[model samples]
Target: MAISAKLVKELREKTGAGMMDCKKALEACDGDIEASFDWLREKGIAKSAKKADRIAAEGLSAFAINGNVAAMVEVNSETDFVAKNAEFVALVNTVCEAVAANNPADLEAAKAIEVDGKTLETTIAEASGKIGEKLSLRRIKTFTKDDNEVFGAYSHMGGKMVSIVKLADATEEKAKDIAMHVAAINPKYISQDEIPQAEKDREDAVQTEIMANDPKLANKPEKVLEGIKRGKLNKVFSEWCLLDQEFIKTPKETVAKYLGNSKVLEIARFQVGEGIEKKEENFAEEVAAQMKQ
Candidate 1:
């Protein structure tokens, strides 16, 4: 039984596998196009498994909104080059859409979602094989708001950063402005009230210790020191809390003042590759390895 070039071409078209891989599959399956397709898929799954341990910290953060519901997703690839691929971008969009539509409870649930009749996890595995890298759905989040609330979404640097904000009784423009501010400022909390008591206590202790260490403050009354500590704490909170920070668009007003009658209900921000430790390659070693190959 001979494998024909035509058969290899057909398999490549079907699976997007390389020409050499397609030929190998055709040969292994005795030129049966259907079997060869399956063979290629199996090979791809194997490739994906082999690359699973590789770090894939580079990719995109994308969001999809449907009516009052919005979903944001981060998809990772091994290299920035692959992150820019149209296929990779489309996959990110599809995952975002699926999460928005299905509102899966968790990351695993989102991965188990069906896309074009295939599980999203399986689809990612297949794509990893075709793209010659490990691909993963890093995170998924969804926000839902009632008719009285509005959802604002923004993506920066293509998809390097994404932010979504839910606002109650806010105009669309204001919502988008707040989302853009969140993306730019990277606020830790919506307001001072959202800060945990333990965290506040810790900051107060730190500031009080600083004041005690100061020579001039050593002679100050306890009441004066307490006021100074409060001021310092407020300054720190202004940086960490969104409502206290000056609005990006209007420097004079804080986000709290900018909102006027509206209130920020919830916010989600994703910075691509935020926590993943990327592997640094030695140029000499890389060149030597490539030369060896």
Candidate 2:
């Protein structure tokens, strides 16, 4: 059967496949539009699977709060452009809403929750194909508190950074301020007391190694060296710990002092592209390879 230009154009419109790919699919399926569409979807899914191996270090970290229930989520895309897409942002909102409403124990449970009558798995697949990139619901954190606790959420830099804090006094204004600080400063712990023993041990070991290599410190007494180490630890906590960190807005006071009667029960922060290593693209080489194809 002879393939018509009209048939190829119709296949392209329905499948969003390239002109050549649509023509090929139409030929392979004997001009059957439905089979051609399926062919394009299968090919797209395979392409997206390959893209899945690519580092998705750029994306948005978003939050949605409903009254006393709050949820935060990070959705990853291969490029920053797709991360800002309206559909991608809507997916983030749906995931956040699912978490806030159901408080799923983990991402898998969250995936099962329906968003607009579709599961997250289907949403991710459709978005991945439609956007021509890998899409992932990377992580989620949800909190539900009693009447005494208030939830504060902040998404900074258009969700490149996100934070959620639980406050004791239910003061929404103060809680939001604290959440903003959490997003901006990137605090490691809510308070000095919350700092992990392993972290303290690591810092002490680093300081000990530094002192060992210093000739001037060799003559210091063991007690004096120990005191110095403690001092260094205190200084680090003051900078890295949330409660002890100097308030960015009011430098004269620490975040703890700024909080006054409102105490932070919990804090969570997410920064996009935190640990994923990105691939270096050589556009010239890429274009050359595509030209060959």
Q: Best candidate, TM-score-wise?
A: 1
> What's the CA RMSD for each of the models?
7.9, 8.4
lDDT for each candidate structure: 0.88, 0.82
Clashes of each: 0, 0
Worst 10 residues of 2 by lDDT: 43-52
Error of 1 at 140 (Å): 0.6
CA deviation > 4 Å runs, candidate 1:
1-43, 285-293
**Residue 102 shift from truth in candidate 2, angstroms:** 1.9
Clashing pairs in model 2, backbone N/Cα/C closer than 3 A: none
How many pairs of residues collide in model 1? Answer: 0
**TM-scores, each model vs. reference:** 0.83, 0.80
> Global CA lDDT of candidate 1, please?
0.88
Worst 10 residues of 1 by lDDT: 43-52
